[model samples]
Target: MMPLPGPSHQPPPLHSTAKRGRPPAPISPDAGPSHCAWLEPVRNALFTSGLTLDDLVVRSGYSKTRISQLLRGNDYYPSWEITFSVTRALGLPTRPLRRLWAAAAREADKADDWIKNCIDRVVHDGEEPPLPYQAFTDDVRGVYTDYARAFLLTDQRARWVVSQAFDILWVCWNTATASENLHRYAWRLLRSCVIARASRHQDGRPDLRAAVFSTRGIRDPDVPGHLVFFTELIDLLDAITRLPEDQMDVAVLQHLCGAPHHVIARILGLAPALTRAVDHHARAALEAILTTPTPE
Candidate 1:
């Protein structure tokens, strides 16, 4: 078959060919909705950075076509290496992007080994955590894991969240150390990791229904009493989730995780007085919620 003429009449270009580079193709329809969560932000970053395909090519060390493909979410999923390069060039924060990329990878059914390999290829500084960073991780790792486990209600998931938090913190060690509160910085990283994976309700608050199942061990002896206690616990937990952000965090870390007040203050980067006040308010609110009777 012979090729047809391109067009009856060519349309005007959006910009002068001299000044405009090839815009990225529309994001591939094959990409899942979950993938778009991270992909859209990446495209937005590129647009706001005012970087052209050629600029991305130069900074990301990938070809123009590859860079364009990555931005468009075309063909196969891009490895963490190229994605990280583009994001780094755009000066986006690595921590949240790392979580989003990992979620996209899982949605794409990328194997755990493949994900790790892709992440490992993106070296930071000397590709090793500094001595001080390592020491800090060692000191707080256990407590961080405990807090994650209590909030998430699963040891395996808690470990994964903690691992991801530590890896991102490792990448941003210099910035974390330079911050006014390293403990608080690391704590925020861990919290973000956990919450990113946490299931949510229709209203967008965390759906912590799994917490009820964690109390099953206490049901062995008194079935009736345990059921009543479980019902009350559910209402209490629901109330806790509705608390203001700082109060909610304080309640979860101090009451749910059984961490000391001073430790909670350090982890939250709050003054001890502020932390105590938040705890007091949280308790008062929970008490008011549970004690108030329902009207017919």
Candidate 2:
């Protein structure tokens, strides 16, 4: 991963990119009605299995309404029992779905922690304090650094991308009211910045596979026996840039930036269901792109 850029090379001032008009309504930690990420996969699996909600109800011994609620994320975090029951009904492998469920659960826990910290600060310290900007910068920088390295393929360029993202965040912070969930909001800003930068630079160009192959161990280390791995990574990045803009945004935000569906929906001004649909299509597109034979 690339190192975070220092303060010297500041990104340009935010212009039309910041969407700086009528601040979005303050978001609650559990504000949205969107389901968890695993819900769509489960739904797809159920469809493939020729099963309906009624069939799920019968299989899980849960009412239609209850099953709907669990799948819709209407009850905030779904219970482990509910997830396990749904997994059984879907008749798919357990581990991947379990991992998604675990991630959702962890996000819920983080929300709860943010709420608790706010309460502690207000009641104990007598002021609702915002997290230090540096701390927030440090936390998000690591994730964006990995994402930048994966996409840009050079440490200097990756650091520039991350630096630009933070510059956007700083602009948003000064202009908009502090959201209740600071980290989530900051992430949204960074995501937008990265997407805009990637799109602007891509310019509908073909893959630079030749250039990438020629560089080899110069920019990124070869590690003696990892040539194939490095080649695949470059291919993946090239494929991601080729994805449709909306699909690419969804893929980057969900997988690269680690934003949940609802947050992604909010950032993109999209409905949660639509967001999930785009994500599903994006994954399929990426799979096809990755699996296609590269020209000799």
Candidate 3:
């Protein structure tokens, strides 16, 4: 049966490709509704305590602009040093702020520890590890085999496939709150596993396949430098296939054009006949997704 065209599941908009160093926005007089009452106390405390911006800057090692922005009411969300320096600068003996400071310090420590635990779980002595997201392979299998049993058209294949893909996302999302680096690694890891999961039935795309798992293991131009480079390339390819039109995104396209097909096919389970179809499908999907309107 002819597959229906898939919905464009473009990734969320990202920050500008340029490096992030946005200038502090010009503070509106109307800005910062909640902290207005404390502004005078905070400012007067700075003066009475003899804690100049220079002193706080020197102690915290934060830049002049950062200190200036925090103090002049230009910014309200205070940093660790800003808050602490104010407390110490004021010589406040109050137990309330001290408790708050302790909680903030504890939260920061917890974030660090949480990430370390995830790292330990994901990477063993030195080998690639079995990831939690691989459980979604069941979803992939069930969708292909059992989805036809449901009322929807096989054309709706893209919808179900994309939905199951969210499980991999959940695994990564849960891990991200603890350690972003680990989350990134897990995301890439899941991408690769997903290719293998879906590849069970497809015909194949030889050149793309060779690139995904070449025994020779040449460093391809399209692959990213992170830990899961090889498998991610294949998963990017598989994502193209599972879509209604069978295409990859620009992010995924970069990976696809990099390597040979047999490698991609083996890793992603692409069939012998479907390679060219996948390539075309990926390109078209990108176009449609790029132009589609999104919900608020």
Candidate 4:
């Protein structure tokens, strides 16, 4: 307290972390919800390409802090410019990641609308506005390809699962207030429904081999002479259905639905490390089961 600092010697402002060439620190993973599913793939691509966060910052012309936020899913929704830049920097295929980014952005915008509507209804004591069916349907349609692929692999149950998911959503809209993120909630509900249906079908199976082979129309006309391959595929699906619930769910999400581990973790309310371990165990079990010959 003996001497006061001069203007030139004053400490830097708290918000002035940005520098001409220096990048900021990355945010911790636990900082926020990991809703952006495409981020993990971008991180993996960076690792595979031997690139660093600084490299991404430089290439994308975004500050290190913003890049970190987007990559870590700390941002509620990433912008298209950020997505394009990061995708370009990582040399990843753009279309799928773009679709995920777009879906997330739409959800974020809709979340704001939902929150406002909720507040208005509460303050005015008016009848809650009906949920926007068109917007909801559009959001579902965005990810339907992946969702259908995941459930269809088992027994062509995609149509049924989609219908059931929408029905559940309608019920939820009538009963519950708006959620923090409606799209994520709806997607998780859909996945849970699919998993429950798959488990119900697999329960109490004594001889999986007999049951799998006895099922009709397991063959694909597109593959002219790969009967053995088709049979092996069916056996693999049966093995997947036999896995413990956590492992089975992780496997279906990762492989069939093409979800990243972080996305699976968020959807299942699990830690990322736990999700990765479950997927690893599931893969190992599948390998063991698939390699073993079926009883004659």
Which candidate would rank higher by TM-score, 3 or 4? 4
TM-score winner among the candidates? 1
Q: Supply the global lDDT for candidate 1.
A: 0.73
Flag the better candidate by lDDT, 2 or 3: 2
What is the overall TM-score of model 1 with all chains considered together? 0.68
Estimate, for each residue in 174-290, the C-alpha lDDT of model 3 and write its tens digit: 333344354234334334333423324346421133334432233554544543665554544444444542244222423423335553343334553565567666667755654
Whole-model lDDT values for every prediction: 0.73, 0.55, 0.39, 0.54
Give per-residue CA lDDT, model 1, range 187-288, as digits (tens).
887777777678788898886656766665344646668877777778877888888878888887776777899988977888999899999999999898
Q: Let me know the TM-score candidate 3 reaches against the reference structure.
A: 0.22
Score every model by TM-score.
Answer: 0.68, 0.35, 0.22, 0.38
In model 1, state the lDDT of residue 82.
82
Which residue segments of model 3 deviate by more than 4 Å? 1-28, 31-33, 93-95, 98-296
Clashes of each: 0, 0, 31, 0
Q: Is candidate 1 or candidate 4 better by TM-score?
A: 1
